[model samples]
Target: MRAEVDRFRRGAALAALLGEWSTGPGPLYRKLADALSRVAEEGALEVGERLPSERELARSLAVSRSTVVAAYDELRARDVLDRRRGSGTRVNGRNRGPRGDGRVRGGQGTAIFQRLIDGPGPAISLACAADEAAVEVGQVMREVVAKDLDELLSEPGYHPHGLPALRQAIAERYTRFGLPTTADEVLVTTGAHQALGLLSQVYLRPGATVVTESPSWSPCLDIFREAGVSLVAVPLDEEGIDPNGLAAALAEHEPALLYVMPSFHNPAGVLMSSARRRAVAELASRHGVAVVEDNAYAGQNLSPTASLPAPLGAYAEAGSETLTLESFKGIWGGLRIGWIRGPVGIIERCARRKALADLGSPVFEQAVAARLVPRMEEIGERQVVSRRQQCALLERLLADRLAGWTWRRPDGGSSLWVRLPDGASADVFAQLALRHGVEVIPGSTMDPSGAHDDHLRIPFARPRREVEELVDRLALAWTELRRHGPREETPIRPIV
Candidate 1:
């Protein structure tokens, strides 16, 4: 039985890739049960398997031994898993296939599945993003109204380049940030996503090569694929993208677009070093490749650095070659405003395309966003403090509870990147976590094609207690799954 479980664990090691959201925030045992169900659904581990002993599983999963016992206890009740007095736990060796309808398993216990399947009554979603209407955002709204009120009254609505006042305001911001700017150099768009999409459509010809880091955001990949750019991924290390690997790819592929996330990288909070950033920019310049610099999260990094290099565009293009994607989303995601700052020629071309696509972004929203961008720093302090404390809480829990995992502390971001011990599946574990009542995202969430299965991203946007809840549950789920087989009774009970 132990050998069978070991084989199952080995076979299902791909589980490490899955990361979880609030797969649910509850007791350790219930969380475990949900996680186990998800693993079974993913087919990572199987029936009649002997899991790790309760104490060992608890230690590895970072939970209390009693928690593992309870998780296994819950599964035993559901007849999904079995335990024996002397022989150890094993899978039911029963018939198990993915539940019908292709939905993610574990109903109300998880959030991603609920959102995907259109469940109702879930108003406050903790899916993604953490920005809110703080001092910066609120103050900016008032200033926007005060600044634009007269024009709003006298002028006929709608303009291609947005309210001329906003265009000018945005231009000044760039100049202040060390980038020479003019209203003409910027193409105001609806949001960063649209800005990136437009850039892809305008600059990327079909079947062109584009290079990006692995374990990236899925939506951005969708944008690149839509433009028909063949993607080449560089392995990510402690300090953002491996410069040597990226250098090799640039030589080999000469990709048209080198998508970059230098500051607070998504999913993995790996920041790029100034020296490496300069090197990457220089390479892009030498190759004449356009760097789609996504500086969305750069504004919030306000970290006290010894020496910081100029923006990638400044280093990449001596005069004008770095096409950049800048947005208000990171500062205030609700603002839904962004701009494409690039060479004048490219900006004009994208502008023509934008007019055809949406005839310029909404005037009202852009007007307000203009005011908010200037005071971005003021609004971010509280958020940074809260997130830092939460991040610390998470690290502390991992260190104290889970002995086998390792992670690096991000300098300035909302989440940490954790690398569990070998033979663990974040992806499989994420799926299993649902059976225990928590919703997790595997490294798979960041990748479009299930490529990054080893990394796990845990965003600390929830309350500290909620974060603790998830860790406790995850530990139980991880340990229990590796234990003995299922008993001959139904374990899962319907939630009333």
Candidate 2:
């Protein structure tokens, strides 16, 4: 059987998924073989997916080709892999067992984006933690074309470090928000998603550790997992990530990177306190750990009285390695414009990786971004009002229907982090929810250790009437789920 699977063309992509291998009590090839087996068992390296060429794998892993050969030989000997002439090596499906419905084993555990997208789409997509394009998006595009059309049309249009003026604009935006940065420090990417992936490429290594919040952006968690880094998940609270817990992780794990969403954190919507931000930067700097501050929702706060602190990059000391990721995606999900601001050297390295990944971001998109980034605050203020109204509707509907369901009031973001009743798996609830014409992300999906099984992330981006109907249907579904019981035994399943 030819099993359909996503292939990792580059060794880096595969390495990211492999995560950190244990450095203890074994020969290098033996350890490599065991790690491959674990990834295969987890369903990440799907049965029948071709492994990288040994020489290519060795180059990517920075090991000798002989090591990869020995590792592949060991896996083949154990019946974990199938090696045939001219067919290349692939995971052994006979070893992985049956794929009755054509779905890969353990496929349910993959990230939302990583899952296959076939068949009919969902009726209502609350699983996406983003909103429709802003009114300014269209306006910006028109303006950019009118103003820069001739110049852009005449150019070759490949800029690995990003368009110079756009990079300057992003740098200025950071400066206005309290971080002194130069255009040279910026490297633009397709979106914040790619920004994180690029950073993982630069920083993560096999057998290294990465520390992040327990409930982080699910897709980013997938990136870290792919990098073959051991992830240490620190729990979060009202003040956002616990400073003491972070300090302990830094001291203990000495992670290669500390990925954080300090501003209006995704899914949780808990902003890290100013003091905590400072402490986190201090801890990372002291431990010589690089920090990737996901500032995607930095300026979306809706509360009239609430105040957000400066980007963690501002708090990071001069010599520390810190990268701040920002994007227009928060302004509009379809907007594919984001940039990373960090030290010049790191930005250069990331630019090279970005070039390898994709030649460059779309020039027209960057042109529009350059025109709009300076006015982002103006754009965000309106979005804040709209989102606040939506959030109010969500709260009222939940209050009327689902009693005892609780959530923290986020200052600003597109979603609510809800805590479901005890024993109610969000994954199972999500499966139940889909049948009712609504979709939600299981909190376990965002958790590194799958411990937030009782949580859910509900995006409040749709119209008030749609949201109202969704909540009503959700109540009906919950009632039915309780009466009939959940279908799946596992807490999570593929939610593509």
Strongest candidate by TM-score:
2
Q: Using Cα atoms with residue i matched to residue i, what is each candidate's TM-score against the true structure?
A: 0.72, 0.77
lDDT of each: 0.66, 0.78
Q: Which regions of candidate 2 are displaced past 4 Å?
A: 1-111, 114-122, 487-496
lDDT of 1 by residue, 342-372 (tens): 8888888888878898887877787787676
Tell me the tens digit of each residue's lDDT in model 2 across 325-378.
Answer: 988866786778888999999998999999998889999988988998888887
| Over 4 Å off, model 1 | 1-127, 302-308, 381-383, 447-450, 484-496
